[model samples]
Target: MCGIVGAIAARNVVPILVDGLKRLEYRGYDSAGIAVHTGNAISRVRRVGRVAEMEAAAAAENLQGTLGIGHTRWATHGGVTEHNAHPHISFDKIAVVHNGIIENHEAQRQQLKALGYEFTSQTDTEVIAHLVHHYYQGGVSLFDAVKQATRQLSGAYAIGVIALDRPDELVCARMGCPLLVGLGEGEHFIASDVSAILSATRRVIFLEEGDIGLLTRDSVVLHDKNDQVIERAVHVSDVSLASLELGPYSHFMQKEIHEQPKALSDTIEAVLENGFAAGLFGARAAELLPQVEGVKILACGTSFYAGLTAKYWIESIAGISCDVEIASEYRYRDAFANPRHLVVTISQSGETLDTMEALKYAKELGHNMALSICNVRESAIPRASELVFYTRAGAEIGVASTKAFTTQLVGLFALAVTLGKLRGRVDAQAEHGYQEALRQLPGSVQHALNLEPQIKAWSDKFAAKQNALFLGRGLHYPIALEGALKLKEISYIHAEAYPAGELKHGPLALVDESMPVVVIAPNDALLEKVKSNMQEVRARGGELFVFADLDSHFSESDGVHVIRTPRHVGVLSAIVHTIPVQLLAYHVALARGTDVDKPRNLAKSVTVE
Candidate 1:
């Protein structure tokens, strides 16, 4: 994934472009560049590093212009170098910045080469610039030139273009990747995300697929693919600038971890107002949920783990069959499909490519009832679904998700309660008890956060380990899987999670003093079985680290270490158990001197499949 920003304003836009690129640094970029139209020529500056490096280069050049487009590249098609960076100019007439793959770039380049046009850099974006320049000379204006160029290209793209012939305007188009236009008083802006232009204006217009926008200093005009002018509504963004800042924490991950309590409270308070009723999901949830024969959850990565954790609750409490599938795999496999099933999709950004594609595929197969548990309001997944539950977790800047995962759990648990009541598995008294327990979730998560100092000590021990194993049974197995994923994603540790009963089958052989085993013992029905698995590890000279409940009364032995948590909160135990594991990952990454926010080769949102 990459970041793109374009501004056509009354004042110089170099500073605005730089500020917007800095806001999108969490999306993971290796090189940064900008091209500004100086009325007669396109002045370009490119650097092969972070935005700070590009900022210095821009300052040294003293680049000043009223219209410009900037990009932070993640290096998908070419090497990470200054020569391959964006604002790929062609014929020295137009500069373009793109945020997706051009599947037919090779064919386009061959045809353009035959037309006697030369290329400068090894980027697919250069082809787009040349195509527009070619069209601009064929008795067409700049707006029609860019629109005609986009029709020939294939695959996903969110492109921003600035032509030297038209210095007062910027043109942008979107097919699959996200692109939004920010509305200002005497200025207009374009960015890959709203956070890029949030400081300038809260009002924005999210561009739909196949929609092309022409942004001038004083006006914005949108058109569909068929060249018909269309009116798009402007929505106010609720994300504040302070939410994008790191405030007092050393890293965004740490700040997000501590903000879990507030995130959980805000997400659950919406359901409590509805008294955990079926209508809480949406208007027709009560009528549709009871008619559904089964439920299918489609997600990826951290969102997938949240769905896995809910599979336990939905089947146990609601007494309904539920299946969880990876979105990328579910779209390709020929599995069971029925129109009566409720297809649920989970994503933090709500723009995940695979999850959105899977949801669309299910809908096309006649599954009309779709639900989205997501964080962002204007993202594509939420718009594609029939009903939505927004996780008010605010802006999650960290590459490895922290607060979003926990908030998704809260949303899914609320869905379970509603479904349980609809199925006659839960009565009014039982629903009230679950509701009260949910009201205490914020405080319980805060209490779990107090165990950070101790978890930091465990992190010090974990920092030296090269391999680790996480063990859990039943409902907590998915939590163990999530914990292992957190450690591997941020800390670069090789870790695996298995059901505790599988320890004797094969994994126990790898357990030694050099390997550490983290156990999730929540004082449930499987506590004794998990304890027996721990003994198998201890007997093999392997060290043990256990996060047990307070009532479990686990003691520290010669080879075993235990950190007792607060009392378990029934179905909410999985949500509470996730806190210490997240703290462990953050602290371990800190101790290892790794990039805690943007891990290597990972972007915050997977916009490309």
Candidate 2:
């Protein structure tokens, strides 16, 4: 996924746009470009690297304009080179910045070439600027040209166009990707995400599919594909710009990992204050609890792990059968869903492509009671669901999710406890106790984060290892899997996670001194079984890094490195346990000199198949 930002200000907007692009750099970092409209022409500057390079090049020259659009590209349609960078210009110098894929661009290129249009770069976005120029040359208004060009294009796109002739206007449109309009004082802004313009304005208008936004310094206009004017309202975002900064951490990943406590606590507060549990079933949860026969949790990546944790909570606490499936696979499978079944989708970026598709498919199959636990408001996933519980984990920037995953778990736990109380499985006193435990989660997470020094001390041991294995049992199995994923994703290490009992089935051969086995050995009922598995690993000369509760009777005599965490309840332990593992991955990656923010061959958002 690419990040796009446009501004039409009364004063110079290039600097503001560059600053906004820097804030939105987490979206994409392959290349960066900017297009600003001067008095008579559109000035463009681009480079094939980080935004800092583009800024350095721009600073060497003067790029003065009051209207412009900037982009940080992830390079899906072309390679990472200067020629493949964004702000793809037409023969007449019309510039465009795009965020999504054009599926039929090859055929469009052939048709345009036949009409005597020459292409400079091998980018699908280049076709859009040429297409727009073709329509404008044939006597069409700028808005009319974009409308005509988009009608012929197939697939998803959120595009911003700036023409030489129209210096005051910026035309933008969205299909399946995200786009938002920020309302400011005598200024207007457009961005792929709200963080880009959060500093300029709090009021924003989220563009829907087929809605076109025409931005100017004074006003913004919305129109349908049919060219009919439409009225749209603005929503003021609750997130502040300060929330996006890294504060004192070395990386966004570290800051986000530490923010888990506050994130989870805020989510708990929101759920209680907004009556979200009561909102789930509409009639105080008791009337509808008996009717729910099954639950299907759909998500992708780290959110999928959250669903796995939720499955355990729902089955154990609420006495409901539950299954967690990856959204990409869930959309294609033969789903046994009915009106009595609930489909819950978890996503941090609610715009995740596969999760959105799965939510839409489930709705089409007549699952009326669908719910979303999403961090982003007004995203496609929330729009596709019948109900939503927003996770107040403010903008997560790191590619590997940290705070968002933990907050989703908190929300799911709240839902499970509410349903358990409603269905007579737990009394009010027990529900209150659980709620009180949730209230103290933020403090617990802060305490867990205080173990950073110890975690860093063990970093060299992990950095020297070639492979790692993570093992856990019961609800902690998913945490083990997620810990392994974080290590592999950022450090480029070969890591595998297994349910401790499953090690004997196949994974035992891989245990050796060259491998570090991470055991999630919280002092739960399965602690003994997990410790037995640890012994098997030790017998095979596997280096051990065990995360255990303070009072757990795990011995350190077997050359195992034990990191003790504060004793927490079974339901809230996942939140605390995730912190040390995340810190371990962060320190290990840092020790190995890896690019912790943008890992190789991976983009922040997977918008395309």
lDDT of each: 0.91, 0.85
lDDT of 1: 0.91
Tell me the tens digit of each residue's lDDT in model 2 across 1-609.
889999998888888889888988886568899989888878888998789989988888788889899999887877888888888889755789988889999999999999999988889999999999999888988888888899989988999998888878889999888888999999999998888887788899988889888888898999976668997778999887878887888888988997887788778885556542556423434455556777889999899999998889999988888888999998998877688887889988888888888888887887877778899888887777766778889988888899999989987887787667667887867877787787778887888898899999999998977799999888999999999999998988889999999988989999988889999989998888888898898899988999998789776765699988888556888878889889999999999999887787777777665
Q: Which candidate is the best by TM-score?
A: 1
Supply candidate 2's per-residue lDDT for 300: 91
In candidate 2, position 87 carries an lDDT of 89
Task: Write candidate 1's Cα lDDT for 1-609 as tens digits.
Answer: 899999999899999999999999999989999999876789999999899999999999999999999999998888988889998998778889999888999999999999999987888888999999999989797888999999999988999998888987899999888999999999999999999998799999999889999999889999987789998889999999999999999999999999999999999887778777777677777778888777899999999999999999888888888999999999997766788888999999998889988988887777889999999997888888888888989899999998999999988998887788888889999989998988999998999999999999988899998999999999999999999999999999999999999998999989999999999999899999999999899999999999999899899988799998889878799999999989988899999999999998889988888
How does candidate 1 fare on TM-score? Answer: 0.98
Task: Give RMSD to native, each candidate.
Answer: 1.2, 2.0
TM-score for candidate 2, residues paired by index: 0.96
Once fitted onto the true fold, the runs of candidate 2 whose alpha carbons sit more than 4 angstroms away are 225-227, 271-276, 280-291
* C-alpha RMSD (angstroms) for model 2: 2.0
The ten-residue window of minimal lDDT in model 1 covers 278-287
